[model samples]
Target: MKWMQRARVGSTLTLALMVLFLTGCPKRPEVVETVPRAIAPQGEVGMPAPPPAPKGATSGEKSPTEVAAQSPEAKPTPEVGAVPEAKIAEAEARPEIAAEVKALGLALKDIYFDFDQATIREDSKKLLSENIEWLRKNPTVKVTIEGHSDERGSSEYNLALGDRRSRATRDYLIAAGVEANRISSISFGKERPFVLGHDDSAWQWNRRAHFAVSAK
Candidate 1:
């Protein structure tokens, strides 16, 4: 009975030591969550991002469209109106051109022709030479060499003869260094006469070349 009691005491001591060892071993902590103090959920956490830039206005400097937006008072800027000096000079030269044409028209009087002949007369040749020189001075001046005839010949024949006469004058002017571009020829036949009389003197005057300037 003493031995049994001693054995029971030893078993009791062993159990107590085992329980203490188990209690001293590390253990996972239990999470105890406390109730959070109530407040308005501070809106949303992240800040609002800035808006994207306008299309084509990627450059740091303001584009034309952007500049207008920033300043409401700004008016629409017009494109520069400009003209070159040469064009202005050309515009100013118009009056001088008209004057030159008038001067040339006045310089040439009527030129006479022989009866039934389309040949350019000697005196008329001198006048043509002077006219050609003037035309050379002003290259832009255009002249129409019109051939006329007296009423004695048939209208058809006179027309043909008149054409030949005007062409002869044009050729002579060309030979005298006047550019072909500056001269032209036409035939009036006997339909129009500067002198209405039927006498030889009138016919002589009628069979001739008349000079006139073109309207600008």
Candidate 2:
């Protein structure tokens, strides 16, 4: 009977040991991959997303630095010795500009007359003829002849003499084939003496017809 009791206790302890071993056994360690996740960028709350780029340029995705940038006023300078297209067009449009520019360089001299007479002096006629020729060559050029006189005569008499001298000068120019309209005459009389003295030399210098030119 004691042996039977010992056998029952052994069986019970063996079953309890088996149950504790099964419960305490460690499970195979799980080794699932743990790759890091990338977080997406957050956009502003109320701002709408940018529209997709156009079909062509967007495809290239070109850098802004790739192409040279130029503002409206940053035009390339013209090459040396090259005329600009705008200036060429202007020259073509205004043909008279050439004549006007040429006229700017032309110069004329004064023609002196006798002290008391309006007749163009013998020496002065030669100069007058040269002036006439210039007027003929530049038909587009107009001339103003200023008749001045000495301080000997009355203001009224000198003014009248001055007018006669200017008229005679105009008539001569007209007869020499210069356009009558192109030659304008004015008189200053003793009021504008060329020399401010009462001597013969001064009077001689003052009794003269002076010329000025302008482009038509």
Candidate 3:
């Protein structure tokens, strides 16, 4: 009976040893799971985000149309009633031109007269016609007919003859279509002789009507 009891105890000890050999030590318990965290969108956290746009402007900057409309072009200013310097110079030069025309008219030929005669000779008619044409061309010119006489004539008689000769020359111009207002007559008589000689050569040159020119 004691042997049976010892065998049963040995069987129990053996079964305990076998279970220990088959299994190792127990594992540690797993950690608890935390609640899911909210993540930021892209370019957040350690990575830098893009800079914010300036006030009143888009991210890409201002449009070309908006920039052009804000700026305007400047215009040039004009002077009022201002005359050019060149035109002022031209206005100042007009009187000199008129004087030149008057000088040219005086340089033309004079008409001659016969001794003690008031009538214009046929030979003198061509020269008178030329004078008339010149006067016509220079409408603004005025002329004086100065009659002279030979030294042989008496002073009083020479003056009378000179007056008649001046009138004769003036009338011929008037008749040939020269403006009567443009011509005037005077008598120099024997006082202003053209030549100082006693012969006919001197007398012939002294007895003449001379032209003097002026601007109208």
Candidate 4:
């Protein structure tokens, strides 16, 4: 009976010890369903959120720097020597005036007359011939023959004489082959004296017919 009682006590003690050990034992690691620690958005980890962009900064408001950057007028300008498109077009539109100036001589001064007369003298025949040739060459040219007289007669008489001189020159030019339509005559008479004095040399200079050429 004592031995059976001892055995029962030993069994009870062992059973209790085994139960306590089993309850206190550590468990194998497992995937826990714990909530994960909060993480910041990308490109940031530990820093605080940037202060809300100063009021209207993010609301379509443009800064001075942004406005300047958007302006096309602020772009770098090209140099002056760069090709100018409008000037090139203008230069091409108007023909040069120098070409017209070059076509006419500085002066034509060979037309002469006889002493004290409006006659187309024998000596001036070659001159008239050359001038007629010029007129034929340039059919578009119109000419005016200005007749003058020496201060030898009354103003009225000199005027008539000047007219005769101019008429004689006109008829001669027409007969020599210049178009009559292109030639007109004007008599200045003694009103316009080439030489102002009352001398032989002055009279000789004044008695003359001048030709002035112009474009039609």
Among all candidates shown, the one with the greatest lDDT: 3
Candidate 3 deviant stretches above 4 angstroms: 1-102
Segments of candidate 4 deviating more than 4 angstroms:
1-107
Worst ten-residue run, lDDT, model 3? 73-82
lDDT of each: 0.80, 0.79, 0.83, 0.76
lDDT of model 1, residue 72: 75
| Per-residue lDDT of model 2, residues 1-216, tens digit only | 999999999999999999999998998899999988974444676666666565667665664544434345444457646677777767786646655644543556688888689997789888888887776676787878888899997999988888888888889888888888888899998899878897897898998887866445
Candidate 4, residues 1-216, lDDT tens digits: the string is 999999999999999999999998989789879888985454477667655556657677887788888988865335735556655665885324434533542244445566667777787777778777777887887778888888888899888888888889889989887789988998888899887898887788788887776444
Clashing pairs in 2: none
Return the top candidate by TM-score. Answer: 3
Error of 1 at 156 (Å): 0.6
Per-residue accuracy of model 3 over 145-215 as CA lDDT, tens digit each: 98899998689999888989999999989998988998899998999998999999899999999888855
Relative to the unseen true structure, what is the Cα RMSD of model 2? 10.1
lDDT of 2 at 148: 85
Off by over 4 Å in 1: 1-103
RMSD of each: 17.2, 10.1, 21.5, 16.4
TM-score (C-alpha) between model 2 and the true structure: 0.51
What C-alpha lDDT, on a 0 to 100 scale, does residue 206 get in candidate 1?
Answer: 90
Model 3: per-residue Cα lDDT at residue 184: 93
